[model samples]
Target: MPRAQQIRSRSISASPFLKWAGGKNQLLKDILPRLPEKISVYYEPFIGGGALFFALASQRRFKKAVIGDRNPVLVDAYQTVRDDVEALIEQLGPHAAHATDAEYFYWMRALDPSSMSRVERTARLLFLNKTCFNGLFRVNRRGQFNVPFGRYKNPTVLNPDLLRACSEVLQGVDIVEGDFEALAERAGPNDTIYFDPPYVPLSATSSFTAYDRHPFGRSEHARLARAYRACLARGATALLSNSDCEETRKLYRGLWVETVAATRAINVVASKRGQVNEVLVVGRRQSAPALRQVGASGHAVTSSSSLRRSRAAG
Candidate 1:
């Protein structure tokens, strides 16, 4: 077996997928157990970087899985990987070399996604994602890639094995490019929905991390809160992650919410790097963290449990 095969031998995990900021690489373990076992379909609408999809697809095979993103570039990248990955890898060759400057960022951004063939567009998205600052996919109000160049020495510009593995599970998934609310018409009972929306703006003064040019404001948050409530009323299981902020807690107060700290590269500022507390609000009730163990593997596990299932999938 090849080196990649050894990693694949483990259950589905959150690794191998491209690294991106706000990706759910951490904070999936506790959320997974809360998921119901009889769900016929798995749906993720706000699939930012899709850390959860890649993780869940590893162990179980759902009859139907739907993944979508509002960002057209992100959707195109997933489509190319599922449709034809070889061409994507080939198109990414030019960017495999290093070019750490703001000018290069614009140049890559300017390359038309539709002007190029599908394969070329897919390759461009992959290359920019690998080399861009903090693996972030951000745009300014004018829709330009404004993130600064990240300090990485020879990042994995392309991963042939990983793309192939991801394609295997996405063979028949309904990948779409649209708003999260667009799925409401098709969402049925017993479906599993894992939402990782832009958290209730951690603070009023925080930088713009909105999913799109239009900020997901308080009204939008209330809309989503109502949607989740409706989903629960209709018997759909829901698990969503948001910043452990007052607004978030207030929005989800009546529901069962548990706080767990999952550290990632969210804190761009040097001071707040290691630990960021996020709330995992579930439609179903959870015994408070008072009885759980904050595992080294980024989940709240039972303290007396013996089986140690790590979601890292490494």
Candidate 2:
């Protein structure tokens, strides 16, 4: 399908997909253009809500691609949808029709995954996603989905067409449960890697989504920086999205960076949820335009060709 022709607002590329915090549904427009045309495959290490992969794939095809994530259930959801979307859709039905009450949310959240039918399991995943506070998939240390039920009166949980569409797009992808670094180890020439790790808070007061119970602290950030370095050294195209922070800027130092002022939907407080600045760091050179749009809230847009040029020089 033509790249532009396949892009749609409804019915995403994968079905039975989990609604994740920091999923890039909103960033697809900004990040889509930055992607290089000539590439063998696509790799998304932190494939939370695979907004990018599903969006891009809906319009194009890849020779090979790998979607990896730390959440085993999330990864498994993708795999099941890819293999059999219809069955998965069938599995997700109960969750969509579930009561939006708090009690139902807790009950579904605490269900035994082992004894449930595939349909029930799918429904539970969808239920947690829709009813979770602001579509956040936060699990406790015991691996329990613990977010509270949302405030929506009606939610679309088992979207058949969307799931089928997603299954079509996710066909043949190597969906695995692993660290992003392990996935990045093999990214080389003719490959493009897009990193969307759990967003570390730019400020102490701003941290909200704790994707994993284990803190993704400085060490994890350092590990990501090393992965970027590896991707650049191996001549693969790489792009990273993170909250705009001086510390993160320091982490991705000496790389071609572009700042896009975009609306951030995930926030506990309503007033601060309007707009936020995010940095899109790339490990290779590409011509990018300036000033996407003036967000409702104050945000900055900047470009760092130095990092891109450095990758080329190497």
Candidate 3:
């Protein structure tokens, strides 16, 4: 049997093990149906918690998958899960035992990842992710994991079955690190790329793009918008999700845009946590006319009517 068919035959089930900020799990219902009917190769450049990727993997939605993130630690975790899950599970046992110990959690977080083996580093990240504040993966300017320990009554630090399932689904998949634009450039006519980059901050103080040491500021957002248009020009369908702010709406003006409501779960102030509107932009393979209407420079030629605003439950 062909590799794709062999992969699908396994019929494995998996889900994201890490708790990522701005993860798409809540919005999967809104995002999945917008995917291309047929995907020859699936590309997800900003593979945060990989909620959508795992969902698609469960359904065997694509023949091949190329997923990446700029965060090397995140990529390493995925690689270790895919290439050495048994060892990873073994390494995680001790961390699981010490999940509730604040000293142990802080000690593990303070250790430099460069000094540890791949399995050790992956284990540390997994442990920190499960035990950290709000399950966040924030890093300092020096690239140190800085989130404080989360004293949950019971946190599942290790789940062998879930790891095994994720590993099985990731078989023959590519887990890459570095610039998202590089991965976007690899998309072709047969591929569908999903961009879930750190959202444009709703407000200056509300920015939480610090998944790593590098900041994703306005320039990076502009570059990503260009990359999205390039993917559409290459005849590859592209879907993106971001905050429903004026900047984002202006950036993807001519594309099919829809607003969906998602609950904010990670606010510092309890009173601030509530439903917020996010936009989903879809650019299909046959959207050349729309592209032309917007111009080759990707400037908005049309009005805001192209944006279809409606509130769907996240």
Against the hidden reference, what TM-scores do the models get? 0.83, 0.83, 0.87
Candidate 2 to native Cα RMSD, angstroms: 6.3
Which predicted model would earn the best TM-score? 3
Worst 10 residues of 2 by lDDT: 305-314
Clashes of 1: 1
Q: Candidate 2, residues 209-309: lDDT per residue as tens digits?
A: 56656667778889998998898789787889888777777887767667767786767777877877788886644432332332233122343322222
lDDT of 3 by residue, 1-314 (tens): 24653464355468897888888888876676666545899999999889999987776679999999999999999999999888998899989999899999988988988999999999999999999888888888999999998999899999877887788888999999989999999998979999999999989899988888888999999999999989988988788899989889777766667778898878767787789999887763234213212334322233333334432322
Model 3, runs deviating above 4 Å: 1-12, 284-314
Ranking of all predicted structures according to TM-score, beginning with the best and ending with the worst: 3, 2, 1
- Give candidate 3's TM-score: 0.87
Global lDDT of each model? Answer: 0.68, 0.71, 0.83
* lDDT (tens digit, per residue) of candidate 1 on 265-299: 75567666678777777764442222344456544
Best by lDDT: 3
Runs in model 1 lying further than 4 Å from the true structure: 1-16, 99-106, 284-314
For model 3, give the RMSD to the true fold: 7.8
Error of 2 at 236 (Å): 0.3
